[model samples]
Target: MEKVRFGIIGVGNMGRAHAHSLLNDIKGAELAAVCDSSPERLDWAEEHLPDNVQRFLSPEELFKSGTIDAVLIATPHYDHPPLAIEALGYGLHVLIEKPAGVYTKAVQEMNDAAAKSDRKFGIMYNQRTNPLYQKLRELIKSGELGEIRRTNWIITNWYRSQSYYDSGGWRATWGGEGGGVLLNQDPHQLDLWQWTTGMMPKRVRAFCHFGKYRNIEVEDDVTAYVEYENGATGLFITTTGEAPGTNRFEITGDNGKIVIEDGKLTFFRLRTPEPQFNAEYTGGFGSPECWKCEIPVAPGDGDQHKGIMRNFTNAILHDEPLLAPGEEGIHGLTLSNAMYLSAWTDNWVDLPIDSELFHEKLMVQVQNSTFQKTPVSQKALDVSGTH
Candidate 1:
């Protein structure tokens, strides 16, 4: 194919943003079709999008149209897996948004489908393209930081107002969004937590405050403790209630420690390996010598979402490697699901979580939810700044 033709399955805020990028920013990609269940959203796309771009009221219609080589699934939390699986079954390249799906069972089924297909599969983990995180992953993988001992990430900068939640009924409800903060606003961070360290926790204990800050029924604040197989420990703290919040990720290893915050990376290097120093040092009270250094990072944000899309297109056309493979998305979702399960059971949940139990508990919330959501209306929204 000279250029990969693309179809978007949702025309919501994020979906519309992806459509604009495919139309204007990305090369080697064409916005061939767009789909949305809302007639109002379809009308808005018709007015704002190019006249030649085809439009459909349902994803099944677009998938059967056979006009595009790939599809981007940007619908709600529940629809990602089923839509991607259907597209892959049709022999089309598939790119999914974050949090793969509401639960691991559905995502696993989608991954199995993708594995059986010969088409390209990718995920919109755009943060992986950021040079800052890329550099962190490189250092850890290179053994420059030695064996990781601890990791802590305080990412509470996602502040959402009541009006924001009220804008959509599915914004913060369990039946609607499956979970809050972790599922809606912090999937990128959760993904990065495991992606950068190249590790998954063996057990997780979390304390989640449901409707603590927001009036919604889902959790808006959480603090989790994680234990890895190598005896390493981690702390993940996040919320959507704090204003002027903080975003800091720190990791400690045997050789040194690194801190990333306020767009700066700092490394505190030990003059000698802790093990070697402990074995050789004669002094009883002295510690290993340490030097603090501020590591330099490349300028710019690395084109984030657009970069992932461009790579997805190239992977389809030129056999290029994907930055975030669709199947790997399950790792991050596992962490999030473990946290929620821990809170529900008031105990530590192990890795490779019980998929049946999680789904069963989630269905209880969906069945008992009492929140009534307002129907979506056609309104001008600038989603560029939201992400």
Candidate 2:
């Protein structure tokens, strides 16, 4: 195809953003069709979209109408995988919004469909396009950081007001949107945490606070500890309960330490590891005399979402590699599920969670309806004023 004809399914905030990006930024990509169940949302999209674009109220109609060569899914988190699977079955490329899916089984099914389809399938992991994160991945890959010892990130800045959660009924409800903080807000960070380290957790144990913010039935605060296959340890902390929060990611390796925070990438080059066995042990305060340097970062200037979209189109048109392959999305979803499973069972859930077991347990939890009460910040309460 000379140009990729793109249709957007769901014209919510993210849907509109993707539509805007396709219309204005992503070259060789045309906004062919826009679909949404709500007429008001459809009208809003029509107002924003350029003339000569097709509009539909249902994805089934969009798929059958031949108005689109591919569909970009910006629907609810739960619908992402199913929609993408349907689009793939219809012989159209798909770009689904993040969190991949609300559950691991859905991710697996999506992957299965993609593998059987002839079109390209990708996830919108825009953070992977960020220069800072790209640079961190490079540093880790180059062995400049050496054998990573431990990694920690404080990503509480994902803070959401009750208003944010209350904006959509599906925002914080388990029945509506699977899980909170981890599934909705922190997927990118969680993906980044794993992607940059180039490691997958062998097992995960997490402490999740349900209904911590808003009058919802899902977790809004999560602290997960991951043990990687390489014996590396990681701590991931996030919440939707705090304002004026901070975000800092620190990676320590045998040879150096890279600290990324406030748009600064600082590297502390260790002459040697801290352990006496690895270090020369000079017995001095400075010890091995670490050197500090600022790593130069050159970030791509543009909409990251657009960049990923363009990349996806290019992969279809010119055989270019995708940034976030559709299949890899399963990894991130699996990890998220593992974290939640660990929290629910109070056990270290291993990788590749027993899908059947997890489904059974999740259904039990769903049926039991024993909800945990977590404190919501005043700001959160104000946002969810009704509850």
Error in Å for residue 302 of model 1: 1.3
Question: How do the residues 1-387 of candidate 1 rate in per-residue lDDT, one tens digit apiece?
Answer: 899999998788899899999999888999999988778788999999999999987777888998999999887777778889989988899999887988999999999999999999999999999989998999899998999999999999999998888876656887667889999888899999999999999999999999998789999999999999999999999999999999999999998899989988888999898889999999799988999988888987688999999999999888999999999999989999999999999999999999999999888887777643222222121121133
Encode model 2's per-residue lDDT on 204-273: one tens digit a residue: 8999888867677788888889887778899988887888887999999887789999988899987666
C-alpha RMSD of each candidate structure in angstroms: 3.0, 5.7
TM-score of each model, paired residue for residue: 0.95, 0.91
Top TM-score model: 1
lDDT of 2: 0.79
Count clashing residue pairs in model 2.
1
- Please report the candidate that would top lDDT against the real structure: 1
